[model samples]
Target: MWKMELKLTDKLAIERTRLANERTFLAYFRSAIVFLSSGFAIIKLEMLREVIWIGYALIVIGPILFFIGLFRMLYVKKRIKKSYQNDPD
Candidate 1:
């Protein structure tokens, strides 16, 4: 009788990795929100002439971080997949 060979990835720590990715994403998201909020606060303070510089920074920082977070998460997932496939077991 022939025995079927199953891969180690079939039991890899996928759930943990996913959770970690989510946590990291959320952290970035929170930072983005805070930056955007700061921008809005500055805009609302009637100091647009003087504080406009900070507003521009906030406008760019949030989205930039969000995209970076998304890309990094995908990269990490790919790396984990590779590790799983190269398991010694």
Candidate 2:
């Protein structure tokens, strides 16, 4: 239960934080997709045979980046909820 009522500014600030979090997650997701796509493209293209290692590295890094973003987003979301719930102001 909320200990105290929230003012209009407080509510707006919280909403802004949530929106920002979503935007950040989207950015991470977009980057992951780009990396994954580039990795696959490089691997499939015969002209880029010399730097195949880079393609493999990118493939591995893409999922890691996705998971990192996922965890960070969830952690921040939970923290925000807990903070507002417990705080009196």
Best by lDDT: 2
Clashing pairs in 2: none
Candidate 2 matches the true fold with a TM-score of 0.92
C-alpha lDDT of candidate 1 relative to the true structure: 0.76
Off by over 4 Å in 1: 1-14, 47-49, 86-89
Q: Which pairs of residues have clashing backbones in candidate 1?
A: none
Best by TM-score: 2
**Over the stretch 1-56, how does candidate 2's per-residue lDDT look in tens digits?**
42677888988899899889999999999999999999999999999999999999
Model 2 segments beyond 4 Å from truth?
86-89
lDDT of 1 at 35: 87
Candidate 1: tens digits of C-alpha lDDT, residues 1-89: 34445455655566577689889988988888888888777777874768788987897898898888889888987787676654443
